[model samples]
Target chain A: MEDKVKIIEIKKSVFAANEKTADDLREELKQKGVFLLNVMSSPGSGKTTTLVELINALKDKIKIAVMEADIDSDVDALTVAKKTGVQSIQLHTGGMCHLDAEMTSQGLNGLSNLDDLDLVILENVGNLVCPAEFDTGAVTSLTILSVPEGDDKPLKYPLMYQVCSLVVINKIDVLPYFTFDVAKCKENIKMRNPNAEVIEISALKKEGIDKLADWVLKQVKNWKENK
Target chain B: MHELGIVFHIIKQVEEVANKNSVKEVTKVVLEIGEVSGVVPKYLHDCWKWAVENRSEHMKNCALEVISLKATSYCKDCERMYDTVKSGRICPYCQSKNTYLVTGNEVSIKHIEVKDEN
Candidate 1:
């Protein structure tokens, strides 16, 4: 007697399919004249504080809104809204560690009034691994690394460095207190992703905020001009 | 991050395939998970076990099989391949930093087994 079990050959990639959804979402965002930025970092990396500064810096030049995502909290969103006085929405991942393209789209739908917004920033759940794995349909993905996170973060979390378009080293004001090697950090990031842009900033003391603001404005202008 | 969500996506894909083939029951699902794909096989298995029981009646007892692929990196300077986990981006042989990942970064379904009534 021969084995009767039938094996169906299906060499399909599930992540690739999810990427298709992300691409579609990107197209939708482009059509809506919105530049979606997915910002990711580890917890306590000052992602909210950076966003608050970003809102203040870019809000005067462009229409900005933010979506804060966490496992279970509205505190960051509340802080962003209170500090920046901008349109802010909180998204709970319901135990999920990362946001996929579809989830980002759902959040955008819930955001309402996207018609008037030039940029929509999604503050992804604080984690180095999973957030880098999923494509959140953002025009650009930004990763924040604070002085306290150490310089070896890129070596440990290469995926985060590889996926991000820009890496912002926050808390530069406190760099003198920590042994964080900025040159070594940039080298590690470049080793992982040669094309990625690295910018150092102190979100608290407003150091290097002007350069970041200029880069954001340039990206937005390029998106509009190209569209 | 969320292996459960990934499991859900996998289940949806399997259900679609099963529906197309008119499968009465899905006996097993074989997934080819890359070592560097960031998906934990144990968590995926746990999620699959729970999801099949609650969601798919035909796949209530479906077994999940994961084939973890080894991560390998190719050294541009040495023209050699090495274990990515052990050697990392640096080539162990030539001590060169010019290296790139060749494989072990994929999450895909290899095949599936369906119950036969013949």
Candidate 2:
């Protein structure tokens, strides 16, 4: 007797399951009137400093919280808590490179007073690659690129730029020291993503923080008011 | 690495399908991986081997077969398709950056091979 083998068709993307979960999570957040923003950047790209500045600028107008996702360590969450004085939590990915929809939902649940919060900023793991691939159920995605990291980053990491709605060019205060070109950087970003808005900032020096804050406020308002 | 995460998702999906079909064992899984999907096939295989043995019940010792797809992009200016890996976002013929990827970014499961009781 010969062994029998049957083939079953299961044509689906590997991300299909997660994508569905992300969509459902987005819908739920929408119903609850909460806006989620997933922030991605390379290591030491001034994400923590930038967040502190932006959160301080908007903390008065709206209720906000920050979830810092890292493979290990809780320093980011603590910094955001101490500096901006908003609700903050640390999510340990257990050596994973990125946060998926489920982890994000779990983090959201762990926050105190979730209903009262208007916006949640998810500071994703400091990697340019994996973070962009996984949808963290955020209403919008932002990527931070510092001037020292070079202007051709958009060309190198095309997918990251393509997925991000906003790209913050940070550390502009040190631009004179590096061979970074602002116009060329903007052109590269536009090539990859035409609609993605680029804002130049020096998070350390607090340059362009107001424009970034206004952008966040508008996004939150639109997320709440729009059908 | 993300390959591990992706492998976990694949295992979960395969488990659901096996449970739904009442499959006792899955011997093989076929995947369609695009050239520019950013997933390395070598890492995916390594992750799959570990995950199937440790994490999955019905897919123990399952073999993973990957079908590599060529990445192609459509140039809006010239209205032509070219190899994405070679030309990237900019079209080779017209040198226009106004282009979009048409294919080769997929990470899809095409089918599964299951063994039946005699």
Candidate 3:
């Protein structure tokens, strides 16, 4: 007796399903008049600090919520809730490195007043490599690079820079101690993605926080009116 | 690790395909992985072996076949192509950094083989 085997052709990208889910999630958010922002950065890059500053600045003007994603612990969510006094939830990736579209939708479900919120900020896992690969159905993606992380990060991690529309250079106050060249960093970023907007800020000292706040408000307005 | 996540995604997709076709058991899956897609084949295989048995319903003990594609970058200045693995973003031929990836960085499912009762 001969063995019978059947072959089926299914030529699709591994990210195809996630992409479709992300697109559908985006549509749902747009209909609800909610703007989702995904923030990606390396660990200890002041992502929480920047978020606290930005949220404090915008909390009065609009209804906002924060989703803090990490492998373990709920420290970030606690910090944001304490500082900003807004709705915050923690999402555990169950040892996974990044959050995909499905996980993001689950996180959104955890929010109590998602429909009334004008903006939902997702502080993605602290890794720059993995988070950039998966889209979390965000209206805009921002990557934060600190001055101490060196200016050549864009050259090393091209995909992260290419996917993010805005690049925030945090810890600019410590620039004198570090040898990070802002001009060279901008040039390197332009080499990878010509249209990426860059902003410099010191989240701890509250320098340039107003500009960042303005940028966020503009994004929310544009997302609501244009799209 | 991301490899584990990727394995889960693959299992989910294959399970959907299996149910759509009313497949009882899936024996093999073939994937096309690029040389510089950032996915390590060893890790992927290890994850696949563990996930198929634990996470998947119909793809238990499924064999994974990986085909690697060479990475190449096209130089806009010199109008020539170079091996991406050897010469990263900078083109080795013209020493110009105005180059983009032509191929590679792909992770796709090509086909699957299953058992037939007939």
Candidate 4:
């Protein structure tokens, strides 16, 4: 006797529904006049340090808030709040390595100062592979690529480089110490995403912070003017 | 890795589809994962084996099948397509710098098999 089975074709992405939810969340954030930016990087890529500088640069100009995502720790959120004195919240991913659009929306709802904030920065968990796959409903997506991570990262992890609107080459101050070539990195990034804007900065030394801040200001202004 | 989370997401989708069609027991789940989608098939299988047992009563002992899609890139100047992992954004035919990915960046559920009601 043969066991009976029925084949059902369901050619659907597990992420399709998440993408729709992300688009809706983007529209909602637009209506509420909030520019959300998702920042991703590998562990110890100086994301929190870079974010501290960014918050300082834009704090006087606009109302800012931060959501720090980690697999288990809330230390980054505490650091951001202590250093910036702004509305900051910690999002424990509960073993989820990346934050999806629904998780981002839930995080936004958890923030009590959404009405008073102009920008919401999601400091995504430090991991290159997973965070890039999920859209967190942000207006812009940025990735921090430090010098120590090597220049061939764009070629190895092309998806992360491709999805990012901006790629910040952090730790430029340590460029002399490492064998990282800025031009090579830029070329590789261009191959993945021709339109991605690349900026070199050292969050520790505060070099190129102005350029990054200017770009963020422009993005925020564009979001405000267009939406 | 985040493969466990991905497994949960897939199970959720499968459960939703099963409920919509009134499927009592899911016997198999076919997933189409691209070569460059960042999901390790072995890890995914491991997670599926664990999560399926714990997810739903109908999904117990379900078999997960994965089909790998090749990553291909298209060269603009050479107008040729090559395996992305082997070529690395350079057109092997013409050695052109202007190249872009064409496929192999997908992660989706393609098919589901259910046991017939006796």
Candidate 5:
């Protein structure tokens, strides 16, 4: 007599619920011609500071909204809201290192007037690993790497580099103090994402902000054209 | 870190399978992980160490097996598949730009082994 154990078969994605919600949210955003930019980066990598510059540059011309994901405080959400004067919501993920499309969809739900907006930015939790897996149905996923974090970032974390549409190198003004090689970094980025744009800037000093803004506007324009 | 979350998902699936089959216990689990999936086998084991222990009283002694899937590239020109190390986007046969991925990008529980009582 053999030991009796149960054997059953099931094939399903762990992200099934989140993926479905994200798809519907994406469809809703598409109908309104609103583009959601899923932004990801390591903690204190200047993702928020970059957002500040971006909002400061485009707020008057574009109806931009922000969904800031953080584990504890609403500081980032407040910072971006103060700069853009647009609708900003802070999503407390508690301790999750990533943001799935379900949280993002719920965050976007707070803004009922999304139909009138041109852009929606969902600031993902500060982690390179988990966030790359969640699609969120964002048209484009953007990542930030500050100069202090070393230029070897892309090679160390390839998936984030591979899937990202843009790699924004923030805090270039401090490049003189750091040993970061811009060329090698660009090469690494291009290796993984040859088609993705590389935007170099110092988000804090406001230097190169215009170029970054231009790139965002260009992508948004391209999205509108295709839509 | 996300591995535990994945294990939780797997546990739920395991429970469903057990309920449907009207079985007593789960003895083994088989998983195929892709290199591109960015999942470290060691980390997965560490996470599963805790998840499986907590999920089931019977599964406390069950085994988790991981099979690595090698990433391969596809050449559109030659309509052939090759390993990722030797090729990325270029077709080694024709050196053409038409290339795509053929395999090695997946994470699935392929099979589970168990004993059945009469």
Candidate 6:
């Protein structure tokens, strides 16, 4: 160890290159007319269930696909495939908590063609923290916060709350029974991201989903118009 | 949650600086952690304690100094910028949606104070 040569202090980001590549991937997705939605949340936040409902709602208006990123499991992809009857791919990151652009590009490469689809939702590895730091070629980042997760999640995980484009306050069917304060959650989320659009829904009961789907379609439309 | 990772980054930076300076002892590590970075100061300090305790030789005497930089969104509507504490998404001035983030997303090693054992 004494023989090793040292030098001046180098300030290098551990994630700078990855962020650049993610930006490149986002540009590529923009070119293909594919609006990518990177869905991130803690495990069992109704992300997949909401996706299934979304797929069912807009299958006629748009050709949709899904890339489910999990730590280890084909089960989610299978469920999505069976539920939506659309092309769904599974990405196993082994144990990594996040998915970078390079990781997502691999999945995009495996897809049929970017031009053939209007939407590609990357169901990112479930976590409010690490995935927030890594972008996965997504045009819009959607975060689902379930009622069971509590309202303080926005305040607790400010980065995720701030970066998210849409905040889906899920599990609304049980809102009457549970102590989850919907308005409080919205306030907390707005405290972290004033521009963050929030929608209340129950993925399990298929309630308030039309508005969510509409918000997504509207985002796609806005992206096309603005871009 | 990501405090450990940041600690690792901090250690790596301090090690490089220590090696470059060729000083035996490091008195303090000055860190600039921006508000809204989702890193709690206490948690980061705790992580630093654990991470540095495992470090060898000159790292034992290192003191941590975390400087919090508060970031706030400025509303263009009222053309007023208010001092917002860490992790606020709304603008205190006009509450305009057109406001953008000013300077909250930072995790950098601004400066370090050191002394050589000589």
Question: Distance (Å) between predicted and true CA of A72, model 5?
Answer: 1.8
lDDT of 1 at A166: 91
How well does chain A score by TM in each candidate? 0.96, 0.98, 0.97, 0.97, 0.93, 0.95
Instruction: Show model 1 residue runs off by greater than 4 Å.
Output: A1-3, B55-57, B73-83, B86-100
**DockQ scores of the candidates:** 0.56, 0.73, 0.58, 0.66, 0.40, 0.17
lDDT of 1 by residue, A84-187 (tens): 98899999888888888888889999876898899999999999988888898899888999999999999888889989889999999998899999999998
Which segments of candidate 4 are over 4 A away from where they belong? Answer: B75-80, B88-100
Which digits, one per residue and each the tens of the lDDT, describe model 6 over residues A18-95?
668888988888888899999999998988999999889999898899999988989999999998899999998866
Proportion of native contacts kept per candidate: 0.72, 0.84, 0.74, 0.75, 0.35, 0.16
Q: Judging by TM-score, tell me the better candidate of 4 and 6.
A: 4
Q: Give me candidate 6's interface root-mean-square deviation.
A: 6.6
Question: Measured with DockQ on alpha carbons, how good is candidate 1?
Answer: 0.56
Winner on lDDT (4 vs 6): 4
Clashing pairs in 2: none
Selected candidate, larger DockQ, 1 vs 2:
2
Indicate which candidate wins on lDDT.
Answer: 2
Better of 2 and 3 by lDDT: 2
Candidates sorted on DockQ, descending: 2, 4, 3, 1, 5, 6
| lDDT, candidate 5, A37-126, per-residue tens | 999998989998899889889888788999998888999888888877878889987677777777787788887688899999889999
Candidate 2 lDDT tens digits, A81-175? 99999999999999899999999999999998888889999999999989989999999999999988999999988889989999999999999
In order, the Cα lDDT scores of the candidates are: 0.88, 0.93, 0.92, 0.90, 0.80, 0.80
Which ten residues in a row are the worst by lDDT in model 1 chain A? Answer: A1-10
RMSD of each: 2.6, 1.7, 2.6, 1.9, 3.1, 5.2
Highest DockQ against the true fold, candidate: 2
Whose lDDT is higher: candidate 2's or candidate 5's? 2
